[model samples]
Target: MQFYPKGREQRLSIHHPSVRPRRLAVLRAAGVNLLLLQFLFLGLFCYIFGSLFQQSTHIHQVNVLFVDYDGGAIGEAVRDAYKKLEGPGFPTIIERSASDYPQPGSIEGAVCDINYWGALYTTANASNALTAAFAGGSAASNYNKNDVLTMVWNEARYPTVVDSALETTLKTLSQSARVVYSKVNGKQALQNLDTSDSTTMAIFYDPWTLASTNLQPTSQGSRLIYNTLVIILIMIQEFFYLGTVNGLYVQFKLYTSVRPHRMAIVRFIISAVYTLAGSLCTAGAIWAFRSGWQVNGNQFALSWAVLWLFAHLNFLVLDVFTVWLPPPYVPMALITWIITNITSILLPFELSPGFYKVGFALPAHAVFQVLIDIWSGGCNPQLYYALPVLFVYEILGAVLSSVGVYRRAHYASIKAESDEKACEERVAAAVLQQQEVQLVRQETLRDAEDSRSSNEEQETRDARPRRGTVTTIKDQEELVDIIRREMSRPTVESPEDRRSTTGPSFSLPFTE
Candidate 1:
């Protein structure tokens, strides 16, 4: 998802951020990621999204609103026939709205909501009108005035797939109506309707001939843009986004000593080269599978060159935001892709709401017009208008990219870094002051506890009963003298002791 710093190893060895990848080293790394590493986005775009448009050109469910006003056998028969007709893939969802012929000019607005591809209606007395033709009236008889199946279509609602599908559906309904009418009238003459020689099939039974006003006319190949070029461009732009996001790794680029403008130039070169290769591959696939070799291959090349130019311009424009407003790149890409690709390209402006025209400023829109002009042999003449708009985009991108570069230069230089270092030093000083305050408080608590214990010991010693408290100070000294003298005195002579012993002989209980 992201490119981490490649210079991390070097940064660890040498603490200076200046020891970084040189200009060319950064460019080489970028080129590898841009051209070689980007194939996954390319493959995904081609294989997944490209295959999507190729397969999804046709609507899976063709919605049909059967508005029958005739109240006749022909209308009833066509309704029954439509139900029986089912083909492979998404079946047509038919909403059978039976009514008498809607008021003139009212059908167009009713179908404008575009929920259905087309509508089939019948005029009054559809059976009576077909009766004349069944009675062997002129095969060229006016089928328009008679009861005939009418097919109404809103060409602006969808592209050619729906257009052709609507036509085919109506034709099928017409055939069913014809067969049912012939059988009900017992006209065995019409049984040969399937024969190649049958004239009624085209002249009388054909719905286009039945009611000419019913089918709205549309220009040929109008839908080709939606199914082909638009889808291809969308996929290509999706592929381009992966490479462009590399611009978002500003910190890595900044650490690597690559200047923004220089990096932008490298990016432009790499993008142009990859764009050339991708554009060729895309054009080849489209030509081989869709257009074939009939069209000039030169036009594809021409269109691709212009497409590449616009795509790169778009990348540059996006890069401007990435450099200046880096954080929002992911959401910015999503929002822009949805708005530009969905509103303008996938949903043709003609088929989309009026606000979709805002996407004309998108490079894809202008490039799509140019591509269309090239593919369609210059019929649209959008080259004049589209090219100017694209040129304006390119110019605007260049200016904004330069502004982004200037902004980066202002931030990434030594002056800014010096200021940052000074700010960090101030913050470190403040933290050291806090640590000193805590150490002082801890030392103060230890000293206070030591002083308190010393005081308590001194107080205990003073409170204990000393010899001075037991006797007066002078008397205590005399007592000590008397004790010392008594220790020095020897035993007295034994005369008294002998006399006491002789006298004690008279005592009965005297010890021997």
Candidate 2:
């Protein structure tokens, strides 16, 4: 009936007819192994992110909308010049009709919207501008304002690469045209036999010039914006992972009774703070390395706030995801990895097909733009764009967290009440069954007592002597003949009413 287990194995493996054996099932049954799962998840992200920048290039073939409103000789010459200067990596020049290019009036819109990198428009009087420049000072006096070439661009787009390419190409094209014109004009003067014209011909051919201006940053290219973005992202992710230590510590404390939203909030706070501190320290280190770390008040504040938002959003999302996802660490790390790659932090976004929506949706790309704006142009309209994406994570995630808490807590309370009520019902049923059993025992005892009393009364009746007319049978044989006849004859069928009389006429009743 009883067995005492002497060892752990026997206790753990206890098996009986009434009991099922307990065995350790797989780890996933109880949810993921947190330590292994988290390390592996983070390690995967580190490896992927660390290697991403090396494989990608900022330079890609840009699509330029080339518009020539000027059908003049200079415009035609410029087109011919562009023809000879073509290759794989060069901007693919697509000549657009005035109707085809729904060009934004400004260059900022072009690159900010990322529809096109740049637009080239030559003015209507380019040839006249060139001819006026060829004329002497008295003849060219009124043409001072007549600019030939017009170049406009989104200053924020590939600050170093795009601008450098455009600048270098324009200068080379202009200088080449100037040299050609000088040669042609020199030959024309020699053939015309005009010595005075030869002296004036030294005023180089058709003063070629490109007038460039930016729609956004009036100036450009003091730093590598993408490099800085990548560095910050690397540091941010590093600090983000570091904060997981604090997150786990806080979460362990919170495991007892923290609300889901509160947990998410706390996690975000810890990460954002850690990110800010680490970023500042990293900035200090960067400053130390290259003390030209321009301590622009606006730049530092905006960068800090933007980076903090990204870090905060990262933790908030992970906190929320941990609620339903079985392997908690994987979703966080996997999503972070995806966001990093799709942010187009390494390569130009246009290079990746269908990257616009995905890239912009990612927090990384937004933060990068915010960083660029801060680093170069104080605070700009780009900050307005970046903040909303973070706001979505904040507003939507907080709402979800609150709902998650409310629903789970509500259901838990309901389950507890149901369980309590079920226990009370079971107890009440047992008590009722016991009370019924007690009543049944009392009824059974009473019935048995009544039956015993009836049996005893019958026994008493049997023991007692007959009360009437039995002495006549005790006298003589003839007198007893009545008893014998009564015994021999048939008895009456009813005791209540006598239907028939048998042999003895004399009344002789025998009782025993």
Best by the TM-score measure: 2
lDDT of 2 by residue, 346-427 (tens): 4455444443346666666676667666664632346667778778976776566556455555655676577657755655
Clashing pairs in 1: 69-99, 126-147
Question: How well is each residue in 1-512 modelled by candidate 1, as lDDT tens digits?
Answer: 33545434344433345534454455665675456325645643553343234232233356656666767676777756666665533226465544432553455444544445566677766556555544444633555533366666644233454445556656766776567655664455355333343434444444334453332333445345644455546444734563454644443545236666776666567656765676666666665555223357687678678756766676666666556654524343444454445435554443334455676776666776676556545534566778998889777877787676667666667654775577556555555565566556545645565556777756644653353243334444554456446643655658868665634212111111
Score candidate 1 by TM-score against the native: 0.42
Off by over 4 Å in 1: 1-264, 291-293, 414-512
* Global lDDT of model 2: 0.53
The candidate 1 region of ten consecutive residues with least summed lDDT is: 503-512
Q: After superposition, how far is residue 122 of candidate 2 from its true place, in Å?
A: 3.6
lDDT of 1 at 252: 52
- Candidate topping lDDT: 1
